[model samples]
Target: MPKYPAREPLVLLPCRLPASLVARFAERAREQGVTLSDVLRAHLTVDEAKPLGKAVPRKRAGLAKVSGADPKLLRQLVGMGNNLNQIAKLANIASKTAQPMAMVELLITLKGIEKSLEKLSES
Candidate 1:
């Protein structure tokens, strides 16, 4: 992957969206409970990825809505990420002080994290 030399410049755009679109946009923006700019960036980024001639269909054609966001599962994912880091430390010790079987448990933990990530992506 090519690395960017600098952060992308931000420009404030003032524009209007359709009524139905505004509703969908508002719903997605609310899900993050963050700044409106963040949600707009996410949606518009998809547009940036597409070919210029192939615009997203109007009235739910190109619009993407957020769904199936499990807060509890999100928390679990965060905790699991932290747990994996801690396990790395233990695995370091285990490699010297304990048997190779100890690393198997770490691999299982990693697999579980991967599965959780996949589930989140699917949602």
Candidate 2:
């Protein structure tokens, strides 16, 4: 049996399909060097057509103009950002290799936020 990602589950979603149709997709999967599951997941989008995977990075929006922004409010925003960063760092260290799925999701979310902050700082 092939091994999947350690963080992912071995989900078996069974459904009826004609043998010929399954063979067709299997052939395509072989030619494409990807699993039949990947092909089907990408092809089907009835529920919601969310993109399958990571998005192409976009150029940062650049910081919003703050020429007339309140000074105290701006300082508070910066402080909040610093606090969030510290929390993320602590979470990273506290969640070990065998962390639960929920913790992994939290880390992913924190990582995304960190990336957003990084792009914001670029401007």
Candidate 3:
């Protein structure tokens, strides 16, 4: 008996697709009892006249209009990262020196960092 099924070698074609279109393809595949890849292959294999499956509607404009990140927010993230590193160093030293108060201070600093992150995400 063969350990693996015989099949052609396949390559992955990664792509970004809209949620609605992906849902439609998934529904079609379910209805026909086939994988999404099978549905895509059928659609791609066309004759001279037309392709398989109904044509999807044209995508809307401004769908990929993403603005650049704010410089201020980037700086804030960097500062927060530095604060975390400092806290980690302090935590190690406090543990070695048996300082409970230093550990408490580190915990407070971590809470502040969490709050700052929450506020940043909200904006």
Candidate 4:
């Protein structure tokens, strides 16, 4: 009986490409004296350790400008937001360390913020 060496399993990756692109790839492979599969594999191979390039910024939809809004109310809302953020950070830290947070105070602050937003919208 003859024994054969084990071979790694191969997977079939079926892909559809335009005829023009396929022809270009074939021509490049012939020029380089390599198979079309080799050319495609070389192009598809990525270096896992290499960091990615900077991302391109996408155009975003512009927000509508709020006309005739009270500047003082906006400032107050901004201050409230800052306070809420601080409380949330503390609450998160406490929860992670198995400590209790002032849940009632947080709820009340949230409600106040909601009411302020409604008032701003009405004006």
Query: In order, what lDDT does every prediction score?
Result: 0.73, 0.73, 0.79, 0.74
Give the TM-score comparing model 3 with the true structure, all chains together: 0.44
Q: For model 1, how does the per-residue alpha-carbon lDDT over 55-117 read when each residue is reduced to its tens digit?
A: 676664221234455667656766887888898888898888877788898788878878878
Ten contiguous residues with the weakest lDDT in model 3? 60-69
The parts of candidate 4 lying over 4 Å away from their true place are: 1-70
* Cα lDDT over the full model 4: 0.74
**Candidate 4 local lDDT, 3-119, one digit each (tens):** 235585546799998999999999999999988877876676456336789999997643323545466766777788898898788767766776544665666777888887799
Quote the lDDT for 105 in model 4.
61
For each candidate in turn, the TM-score is 0.37, 0.30, 0.44, 0.35
- Model 3, position 87, has a per-residue lDDT of 93
Query: What's model 3's lDDT at 114?
Result: 92
Sort every candidate by TM-score, greatest first: 3, 1, 4, 2
Cα deviation of 25 in candidate 4 (Å)?
58
Best by lDDT: 3
Give the residue spans of candidate 3 off by over 4 A: 1-67
Using TM-score as the measure, name the better of candidate 1 and candidate 3.
3
TM-score of 1: 0.37
Alpha carbon lDDT at 100, candidate 2: 75
